[model samples]
Target: MSAPEQRFTPVLLTLPGLTPTLALEILPHGVTLHRLFVQADGRTHDLLIGPENPADHLTQKYTNTIVGRYANRLPVNQDAFPLSRNGHSSTFTPQSNESPTVSLHGGRVGFDYVEWTPLLDPSESQLFTDAEKSHLNGSDGVVGVIFKRISEDGEEGYPGRLLVETLVSLVEPSGPQAESVKTGSELKLGSVVIVYRAKLLDEGKVTPINLTQHWGFNLDASLKESLTVKEHTLSIKADHTIELNNVGLSTGSLLPVTGTHHAHAEKESKKIGEKWPTSGYDEFYVFSPRSTPTLPTRVPVSEFTPTSDLLKEIITSEASSKDPLVQLASEKSGLRVSFDSNQSGVQFYSNNLTNEKNGARKKIHGGSGVSGAGDSYGVGSAAFLEFHEPLAAWLNPSTIGHSGNDTLLASGEIYNNFVKMDVWFKSPVA
Candidate 1:
């Protein structure tokens, strides 16, 4: 690794005059990534794609906000299959998978739809916590938040109880190359990493869990014509695979992504086995194995193709987020997630399915701002960089049952919180 030249001295962003209420839809999560309302050359573009009124129903909608208690899909229900986090548990079916059996992105309503009670400050908006956590650890500028969910028995159908807390923090980036003055552009630079840490407190029973975000993004820089990312390149770093069950469920089944699994076979771009592709790159390569007390510096980040001396890719890319706006994740490991203190597999999906004409940010009247266009589906779109300690990595049915509880820690062990990472959106100088 090389030493960085500058570090990002983060300037807290806050809305002036606009009601702390304007940012309501984004609260409880932390900072809101709003489309800066701007009009240049006699044109108007509100990067956020919203209307003059009722923001939800307007031309612009969908913010890649923070979500959880548990993210992605649980493959069960928060009501029936009670999970054990924070010493209690619940069960709930999710909406992420094609199969009803999978808990996809927090059982339909997870945290996305609901309104979060806001506690506004000048620079940062403190979220609603039935107590989520807040603190300073190891570093003074470091601040941590704990979002906990205590479940009633049989809330999702499974047994045992649950208490879950996801801790998210902002730390000053250190290193010879720590500062980015501009982001995702070739200007003066600095680096600021937004870290999300999670800890689960569970009751006495084994539970199968996976969490990541659905933060979708579009990287095509041109506003007039939609682009296909097939030409974009990708590379995954992990060499091993964890065998998952038929439903891709992993309470305790461990294996690699290289198998007869539907995803492996159905998706050609999945990059399974040793066959690497210069194009159509989409798949999860396991992060280097980390048992515990792992240093963030030591773990090998994913690699990319068209290798650059600057990037730490387990995977590599011809596509540079610096130009043409590539969307790489640890792949949405972008929404970093830690669990039971155990680190597992992370998934990476490209927005091959993004349709500006028919997207979540549709505008009839039109919209556009930070990303450029003033119409419905404008420039530089969002990316879905998800994160989670995959159960698939730990699920090994042969060792245990389909339950896949092969770990010896029993039901009450401690799992470090999940971590959410965003694009540092690097600038030039640092």
Candidate 2:
């Protein structure tokens, strides 16, 4: 007679030290990132904007949850396509969620709505290889959890049984070596790493998949005095953005951000509210292609073993790179967050739709009550940075051979997506 009670497992991770500089809370439902606390300016500040109640995650607007099957939108007229791969062919038709003509964030019931099984003990799961198990064992200041789930065949109109695993971890920051350090005010840094991997279970079935985390961030440290990100400085390393139609669907064309308002924060950091666009940014900034190692053609499920190599590769690449793909900083909090990913582009949404008029009130300090616009909890209160492949590449027949392949996962192949968020604090020199 009553609805089944929803359940969630909360996992806490803290920096390894006598006094922790950062703490993170991860929930297996939707494999959500519930909370993040960063110590800066001699105070502890909550960095993420989420619902007051954890259970609200299911109904909220993707506060901080993993989106999948397809991360962004697809046209409503999604025609069935014969995916011919590995000597087999199957028709694939994506399910629509937003409208009769558009599918938003993987149809009606996406990964965000499901409860992922947590692999707290990697040794118990066959998905991880021995090396991956050891890496997940969390030694030497590393702590994380792996959440996994299976999407049955025909769910959401996608073919094949998909086994998805998401690894979320908090690691101590690696700064300059002691010998190279100058004796000035040092910056304190901490990192949150997310790795997504999936494989098709059917021997010859193929499917399309794109995954991303919808994390809305508000850097102000004080929950009682929460403020909009209007004053925050933003910088993105993108030269162009995919053109979108009036209703926000990709137009199958790329436009340079060189002379538009999109370029305002491309070259240098700028206040988010300065000369703001009327509708705010719901744009996908495109990044130049990166040279990454290709995966093997096929590895049967029985012989397949997900490794730590993908995670290591992301860390190694970030360490060697000079600049991050995206960066956001707040002068008030003296805190900065940087994002680096192997994906080709990132979608930046300025929380433009969150307002009382829209029935989307801001929740303070993850509390139950709502706040008014004057309280800085309304529109522009936060920003969502989603890193993933080009939007609707599959809709265009011409580009499907190249950019579109990023979303296709074939039988005997592995799917991996890596993203890293580094948080730091730097005080002004006196």
Candidate 3:
């Protein structure tokens, strides 16, 4: 196990009868998500960004990796577009030379730098039925891990031949709702669930898959000082976004985040160091619905309730009906993170160029990167919430003029997406 100890091999996921224990880490370069320890009220907190070794996630080029076959940007030569299948035609270049203008995430060796293949299952009964122990709040059983990969076809340039799958479970919370998620009082919980499947082995052509998992959170794992994520405290179920352009791409318009431009505006829950020196946040908000004329009811996916009392607006709920499109908290380490997605846009990056003079992050279309120290990283330090599909359904499916918006993946179709995470704290006497 050399080669940097086989590239920091360590895939843990403990949560079997969780209560004061909640571990997470699935790293093998690109399957990334380094660590997430938690221990609730008695206070433990390591919520995320727990990697300082193993090359420290190579200074964030795709930090918690898993990027895409088309995660973020796309548009090449003469604003490329058009990928006909059974009739041939293809044109949406920049497959990966490292980028100087177009295809960002999924061009240069896309799938987050590659390296996957792990299908774990460590069990011994640890049963749970009683309606799965009343929606896990009791704490008894569940530990999963499935990270397979295979992008062949046209590799990063984008085409058919794809087969990606990722599942990182770790549940156990159901003793009659474990005192409402172990005393947050009632609802604001998640043991962990991140599924994302993809399959399209060219049964006749037609491709365009967008996946995301650039998870980067830093809940003050303190090391004396320097733990500023601008003091953390944000909530976004999206009131509208995706309007970039000026070197950030996405000019398909669709504004209104409460009057745009303040880093793409935000309706409430503010305070990420007071919205930064201004030019941070990358863009793309919009929760669901890609058509039916800008969303005329088709946002259904809520009812997963499991309350018990103790609701102060459940801490400003908003993930679009399902009530958790994205919410981050850190009232001085009382940690709180919630994100739910069926995927229809949710970029939000504020790592703003990862420092070390910014160089060494190449791969816009080329390959090989990882330079260093640009103050090691500034403003907020770490922040991202990618969730894919619908940046105007791939650049411009009429840019939201919507005609039953179709982001292509044709032939038999199947390119699933899932993102649900929950971490607690905020009543341990803060």
Best by TM-score: 2
TM-score of 3: 0.30
Across 242-293, the per-residue lDDT of candidate 2 in tens digits comes to: 8788767888878887777777454556788885888788888887544443
In angstroms, the error of model 3 at 25 is: 18
Which lDDT value does model 1 have at 172? 31
TM-score of predicted model 2?
0.87
Candidate 2 residue 262 Cα shift, in angstroms, is 1.1
Whole-model Cα lDDT of every candidate shown, in order: 0.32, 0.71, 0.57
Query: Considering summed lDDT, which 10 consecutive residues are worst modelled in model 1?
Result: 1-10
Q: Rank by lDDT, descending? A: 2, 3, 1
Answer with 2 or 3, whichever has the higher TM-score: 2
In candidate 1, how many Å is residue 192 off? Answer: 5.8
TM-score list, all predictions: 0.49, 0.87, 0.30
* Candidate with the greatest lDDT versus the true structure: 2
lDDT score, candidate 3, position 295: 18
Per the 3 Å backbone cut-off, how many clashing residue pairs does candidate 1 have? Answer: 136
List where candidate 2 sits over 4 angstroms from the true fold. Answer: 1-6, 177-186, 221-226, 264-266, 290-308, 357-376, 397-405
